[model samples]
Target chain A: MTGESLHLESVAGLVRGLAERRFSSEAVTRHFLDRIARLDARLNSIVTVTAETALDQAREADGRIARGQPRPLEGVPLLHKDIFCTQGVRTACGSRMLDNFVSPYDATVVSRLRAAGAVMLGKANMDEFAMGSSNETSFYGPVRNPWDTERVPGGSSGGSAAAVAARLTPAATGTDTGGSIRQPAALCGITGLKPTYGRVSRWGMIAFASSLDQAGPMAVSAEDCAHLLRAMAGFDERDSTSMNRPVPDYVAALEAPVDGLRVGLPREWFGEGLDAGVAEVVESAVAVLRELGAEVREVSLPHVGLSVPAYYVVAPAEASSNLARYDGVRFGYRCKDPRDLHDLYVRSRSEGFGAEVKRRILIGTYALSAGYYDAYYRKAQQIRRLIREDFLRAFETVDVLAGPTSPTPAFRIGERTRDPVSMYLSDVNTIAANLAGLPALSMPAGFTAGLPVGLQLVGRDFDEGRLLGVAHRFQQATDWHRRVPPGFE
Target chain B: MSLSDEQVSAIAELARLSVPRDALRGLAQELSAILDFVAQMNAVDTSGVEPMAHPQDVPQRLRPDEVTETIDRARYQAVAPAVSHGLYLVPRVIE
Candidate 1:
């Protein structure tokens, strides 16, 4: 098969081609690496391209397939967001602090995918330390949306979403703390899943917010996401918060019928902040579910409006603690010269961190500070319980919640850069899922103007299998996920 | 609560980050605005709520006391900014 045919092939399709020797894995890997070299300069979606290692892995995969012994995901090429540490590869986390840092250990997600015979194309860029809603905050430079080069791809997994949408590789890994994966996947018009927290091990995935952070897949379709998630999800003893439950056969679960699935549409999601075009697109997507013989109902997650504000407090508070390890004396960037220990600590951090990261650190430090802990951190945690309870209550009536993944589709690159509040509000529809540690998937609903709108489906904890089944059936009925950008096509 | 410049600086110091002289005022203003937004939680009565630190509320798993890792000092220190005589070289803290 030629490079264009390979690029358009889904993960399942690529695996079949490899098994049938239609094309060698090395050829597939080269096709994507060549595309990254030729086209990534325009999108700025990649940080490091591991051409030699990828070629080496691809050759090994070809050997496995030729020997009639192959792993489930053998020979599929994919990119990992820079946040996951790939041993001996630069794991910058899209920050200047770790710009020169090469990890000595592979993240569990990276190693697991490698064991499954997946070849890593490269490390995709992201918002600095996974802190921003738009890709504009990356130290490497903003990742331009493939849909419109002038617009953002949505972040902090913006690069991953863009790469998958443009078919730079079949799939990529993305982490969602506060809508990083789902929001970007929606804006870029691809299938992205943020599995329930603890569903996937967090070992060696750089921590942004421990409680809310989850590693999952971004791919061209829900079927592809199901295959990738099957390989990526499992318990690990290394990650303290990793759940000990057995991972369900996600790919097998995708075939389950959604004939009587109860879909919930939270009234709060359609309130003031939602764009009219986005709401219309999401409703039409719901109508597709209705056509699938699923019952859709209006449910109330009354505390949903507080998601952004509560997320800002809780996420940053945990981030301050998680990011404190980058103190310059250890690994990461340091100031050229330091006057004293205090100066070393302060100057190294100030010089190394970007504006958004520093702002979050300061806010987190203040929230966790002695006198203000109850008012900020504790109260935010209490709000988190209320949000979780709201989901619990709604789940009693519905199997899953559906809404717009983002308030609007892709905005211009620099539109919300100066105003942090506005950027925080963009995550309104998606943050509640992260807060409740629920599984959420964002798939292309339709287009608004010229950009894609994402219809988000959120499932109860550990119910990702059911969520994927519903998404897979919807995808079978619609063609939105098949649409590619004008230039990318 | 809105923060003053001094308060912002104090928070920065505690967090071990330095705020540049010119940027302090802007940082303070931005942080205060964020704090005001987060203050919306105060309106909710969390009178009998338990603060959630982890999603699952699972207890921290403990293992048998044992040395699980071998010391690879060279590899560990390879990414450090400054190291000398098998020690990380930091500015002198004591006179």
Candidate 2:
């Protein structure tokens, strides 16, 4: 392969090419930064560009190659969701409150990615404090879909999705809490995966609902996601919730055959709200799986419809607690006036957060408050268990489950922003996976009325290997994942 | 089913959010719509059900007692709004 071939290559392919000396890491890094320069202006997908530091790291990677050191992602260029902390870099979680906050230490995931030799291409924008489903809540500005600038790239990982769809970076890291990763990938028409909750370390990623928050990857293909997940995952003693199981060779699983795999289509996922066009494309993707020698059956996760409400209560109650640290005392934005200690606390917070974040804080406070805890927050937790049990019962019969990643494809910018509930509904189709703590992957299935749709593949906890194999076989049978957004070049 | 202005203000205080009074009505309206949507949860009869705080059945993991990590306050507090003699400074609470 030529050095130019490294430009749009997947993580696995780029690593292969660079390790073979077909292209220097410097040339490849320069190519991607140049692509970002060319394609990112109109998309507004990147929040900050780390070109200077990325090149410095690429130079170090080249020296490692000279030393004959070996690692899987030695020369790959990657972007990060702004939510993850990077020492010395402004790690804004898309909130005005943290706009000036620079982290003191590298997040565990960032350190691992660096150890694997992936160059930092800077941070992608997300919803402020990961509170909103749409990137509209971001302090920077909403990210435009590279496909049609008029439409939103699904968020709160919208920037990461847009960059990959436009090939700004080969792959990037994203955090999912209530569908942030998969929804944005579906809207932008790319591939993304959210591993089982404990599979990836959360030591450095900013907290949302700690129970639902997880970090994974967005890329052009399932093969690339597998490689990125391999580097992003492992047991970290620092994160108390991190699972201490043995990490598998996720990329190797992609090459496995899909023979005899049992896939279940939950009856609940195809109900009243699914867009007709999206349903049609999803059915066609199911047909392709049957053709690939996989067994397909109808299954029911009875509590599926309850995921959104459960997520709303659980996530906010946690957020209401987590965001208390940013009271303008430690770092970032602060108020100019302080009549007393109480005034300082109130004014600093009041001035720092925007409408959407404050709204969630209120909602969370209500749910967990003295009178309503039993009625609202407590009840939501009970339903959450039933939701998990529904998956457990289904998984007993099927190896994997499939659903449409969203009710519809990406909508126009400002289409659902005015109605906050509608924006929250965008995640309705994807949140069950998070609530169940299951591994889920979304890949481009087809298009509807010119917009792309994603077919989500979800499996039992720690079943990322099975999910990747299923996605890889489908990719081999179709070319949808290779389809880029219009005008990306 | 909808949150009121007073409710919004009270909730804000509990959550440590400092919403300006002018923003309360709008906040109440927006949060009302979302709460109304989530109110669907109340319709289901979960009387005898147990509330689940986690997805897994596993117990919480414990770490061995050791001095594994520490932060340098002098360096960390370099960015504080106010710090003095290795302590963070704040507006006086008591007269």
Candidate 3:
């Protein structure tokens, strides 16, 4: 097969082709590396391109294949969101704080994928410390939406989503604290999954919100996500929150019929603030599921409206604590000519962090401070319980909840950056899933005004198999996920 | 619900971050708006609701207290900004 055809192949197809030796792993890796070097300048999606390392790994993978010692994901080229710590590579997390810091150890997800024989292309760009909704906050630069270059790809997984949509790599790893994976996937016209909290290990992935952060897969289709997630998920002793449960055979689960599947449409998501164009696309997508013999019904998640407010408190509070480790003395950016230890801490943080990260740290500090702990932090946590209860209640009646992943399609860069509150609203439809600790994914539903819209499927805890299965069936019935961005093709 | 510049400065100090005096006014306004936005949580009656710290309600798992990792002191200190004789060097706290 030619390089052009290789770029168009899905993760599953690439794995099959590699196994069949139709194309050598080195050829596939070179095709993507060439694409990244030629095309990534326009998108600004990649932070670093590991061409030499990638080629070396590919050559090794070809040797493995020749010796008949291939692993499950042998020779698959993938990009990791810069948030995951890749030893010896710059894991910037899109922040200047760690711009010069090279990780000494690999994140559990990285090690697992490597053990399964996945090759790393490089780290993808992201919002600085995963704080922003749009990718504009990256210190490196904003990632352009492949569908419309002037627009965002959604973030903090914007780089990963754009790379996958542009076919620079077949799949990439993405972490979602609040819609980081799913929203970008929606805006960029790809598939991204945010597994239930604890379903995937968080051992070395940089933390934005300890309780909400989850690492998952972003790819061209749900089946591709399944293939990637199988290697990326499972319990790790290093992560206290990692659930000790057997990972279901996600690829096998994709073959399950969507017939008799119960999908709930949250009434709150479809009501006000939803763009009319996106609503039409999501509804039509649901109708396709209904046509495939799935039952649809309206469900109430009344507390979801408060999720954005609660998330701001909870996420920032945890971030304030998690980010405290970046005190300039160890592992990250430090200031020069400090008069005292106090000066070192203050100036290093002030200079190292960007505006949004500072804003969150201050908010969290105030919330957890002496006078306001109960009013802000505790109250948000209490409201968090209400949100989780809402999902649990909905799940009692439906196998999964389906809705628009984002309230609108990819907005123009610099559109909402000035208004922090407006940027926070970009995740309004998706934040509740993270708060509820449920499995959620965004798959290409259809397009609106030439831009892709995502239909989000949220499932019960550890129910990623069902979410992927449902989305796989939807892709089979609709041509949405297969539609590539024009220039990339 | 708006925060004063003094309050913003105080919060920054608490967080161990330095905010230039000129930036405090704008920072205060932005933070106040976020605080105002999040204050909507007060509308709900959460009187008896338990605060959920983690999604998985599982208790923290503990393993046998043993040395599971080799001491890779050199590797761990490779990224430190300043070091002297294998110890991370920071500005002295006291004379």
Index of the highest-lDDT prediction: 3
Residue-wise lDDT of candidate 1 within B1-81, one digit each (tens)? 779999998999999997878988888889989988888877788899998776677777777789888978998789888
Off by over 4 Å in 1: none
A421-469: candidate 1 lDDT, tens digit per residue: 9999889899999998999999999999989999999998899999888
Give the share of true interchain contacts found in each model. 0.82, 0.75, 0.94
Candidate 1 chain A weakest lDDT stretch, 10 residues: A1-10
Count clashes in each candidate, considering only residues at least 3 apart in sequence or on different chains.
0, 1, 0
Model 2 over residues A1-489: C-alpha lDDT tens digits? 566546557788888877877778888899989888887888878888989999999988888887889577897899999999998888889988888888888888899999989999899988888877668889998888887888888888999998999888999999999888899889888899999988899998998788889999899999999898899899998888889899999988887877788899998889988999999999999999999988999999888898898788888888888888888787877788688777777888887887778777777888888888988888888888888889999989999999899999888888887888888889988999998888898999999988889999999999998888899999999998888776764
The superposed Cα distance between candidate 3 and the true structure at residue B68, in angstroms, equals 0.8
DockQ of 1: 0.81
Q: Residue A258: error of model 3 in Å? A: 0.7
Question: How far is each candidate from the true structure, as Cα RMSD in Å?
Answer: 1.0, 1.4, 0.8
The alpha-carbon deviation from the true structure for residue A364 of candidate 3, after best TM-score superposition, in angstroms, is: 0.6
Candidate 3 residues A87-144, lDDT tens each? Answer: 9999999999999989999999999999999999999999999988889989998999
Task: Name the candidate that leads on DockQ.
Answer: 3
Q: What is the DockQ of each candidate?
A: 0.81, 0.73, 0.88
lDDT of the candidates, in the order given: 0.92, 0.86, 0.94
